[model samples]
Target chain A: EPEVTQTPSHQVTQMGQEVILRCVPISNHLYFYWYRQILGQKVEFLVSFYNNEISEKSEIFDDQFSVERPDGSNFTLKIRSTKLEDSAMYFCASSEAALNTEAFFGQGTRLTVV
Target chain B: AQTVTQSQPEMSVQEAETVTLSCTYDTSENNYYLFWYKQPPSRQMILVIRQEAYKQQNATENRFSVNFQKAAKSFSLKISDSQLGDTAMYFCALRGNFGNEKLTFGTGTRLTIIP
Candidate 1:
């Protein structure tokens, strides 16, 4: 079974520093998304990308956050300046279609900002 | 806007017993999708089961099944013959059939299958 793969299972960065989380979605899938879960909290949608552009984003996805499909399979999320609150588990997901299809999730990247 | 609610924060059941996790959701769209995801200590999100709002028949995968009441806006997961490996956090999620493909997940219910 093909699955979304994320690099750097765990990362620790200082406040005000930049961090890039990488993900390689399933090759055939077109829609991609980035979500985050704070410790003991529900998963929150940050942004969704399709057609190599952002389709939608939540309020939590502010200017500091950006997502790019750098290549055919690589989807990356960059945080220009990390904050203590940015510490959480980031998940990458992809789906074949925008609706009715299940979005497969990656193992997740745990980002800890000190 | 979509909101998924898992009322039970935690639950425990004896091994081989049956356990049910409750979930309710609010969505304006008539057509949508519901899903149950499992997260074990490894913290990896695993898709367990899914249901289409338009389909009245519930979805079942092996020992995992769902009771979906579209009228009541309720979708619950039932794990039968639960094993110790079934212990994990379960999240109920909702996604509309139209624009915005993002999934809205519940707070999650921690389930423990005791030996």
Candidate 2:
């Protein structure tokens, strides 16, 4: 089965440095999303994208955070400057459409900020 | 956007026993979908089952099943013949039918099937 795949299953960055997490959604998927979960916390939505534009974003998705689908298959999330609280597992997910469909998730990129 | 809530933080079940994970969601949309995902220690999340809001009959997949109540906005997951491999974090998610809305996931319930 085709699945969403993310690169660098683990990432480490300096507190003030930048990081870009890359993901390749299912080939035919139209909707993509980025979510994060702090250790021992609930998964929180960061942003969603469709048709090369962002659809919706949560409060946590501020100026420092940006998502881009540079090409047909690759979707990337960039954090301009990382913070300690930014340390968490970042997930990339995709679905066939915006409507009633199940979104598949990647193994996740564990970002550790020091 | 929708919100999913899982009340139980942790649960334990004996091997081969049945266990239910409680979940309730709040969504204004009439048409949508609900799902249960299993996240093992490998950090990979696998879809366990799904329930369409329009379907009155509960959905089942082998040993996994869902009780989807549209009236109450509740969707719970039940695992039968639990095995040690069943030990993982179970998350209930809600997705809206409108727009490319992302799924709203619950905090997750850690389930352990004791041998």
Candidate 3:
């Protein structure tokens, strides 16, 4: 089955530095999303992208975060400045249409800022 | 706002035994979707099963099944004939059918299947 794929399974960056995480969502799927999980916390929604624009974003996704569909298959998330608290597992998911359909997920990219 | 809750932090079951993980959600939307995702050690989130809010029947996939109570807003996952491979973190998620709606996920339940 086709699945979402994320690059740089793990990312380590210095505090105050910039980082860009890349993901290739399942082809033919329309809706794409990014979620993050702090160690033992719930998976929090960061942003949802569709029709070439961000549909919705959470309060956590402040000025530092931005998402781009750089290409037909590549969707990237960039953090302007990293902080220690920014360390977490970031997941990329995509659904064929949206609801009722299965949204496949990538393994995830573990981001660590020190 | 919608919230998904998983009360049990961790649960263990012997090999070949059965285990059930509890999940509860709060949502006023009439049409929505519920899903159970399994995250193994690799941290890959895989869909275990899904249930549509409009449907009254429970959803079952292989050894995985769900007990959904729409009225009570309770959705529980039951794993029959558990195996060591079944050990993983299970998350319950909810999403509305409306536009641009994102999924809300619970913290997760850590399930362990022992030998």
**Model 2 pairs whose backbones collide:** none
Query: What tens digits encode model 3's per-residue C-alpha lDDT throughout B1-115?
Result: 8999999999999999999999999988999999999999888898899999899999999999999999999999999999999999999999887673688999999998889
Q: lDDT tens string, model 3, A1-114?
A: 688999999999999999999999989999999999988787899999999999989999999999999888999999999999999999999988866687788889999999
For every model in order, the TM-score on chain A comes to 0.99, 0.98, 0.97
DockQ scores for all predicted structures: 0.87, 0.76, 0.78
- Model 1 segments beyond 4 Å from truth? none
Q: Which should have the higher lDDT, number 1 or number 2?
A: 1
* TM-score of each predicted structure versus truth: 0.99, 0.96, 0.98
Model 1, residue pairs in steric clash:
none
Off by over 4 Å in 3: none
lDDT of 2 by residue, B3-115 (tens): 78899999999999999999999988888888899998887888999888888999999999988778888888999999999999999988777763677889999999999
Of the pair 1 and 2, which is ahead by DockQ?
Answer: 1
Tell me the lDDT of candidate 1.
0.95
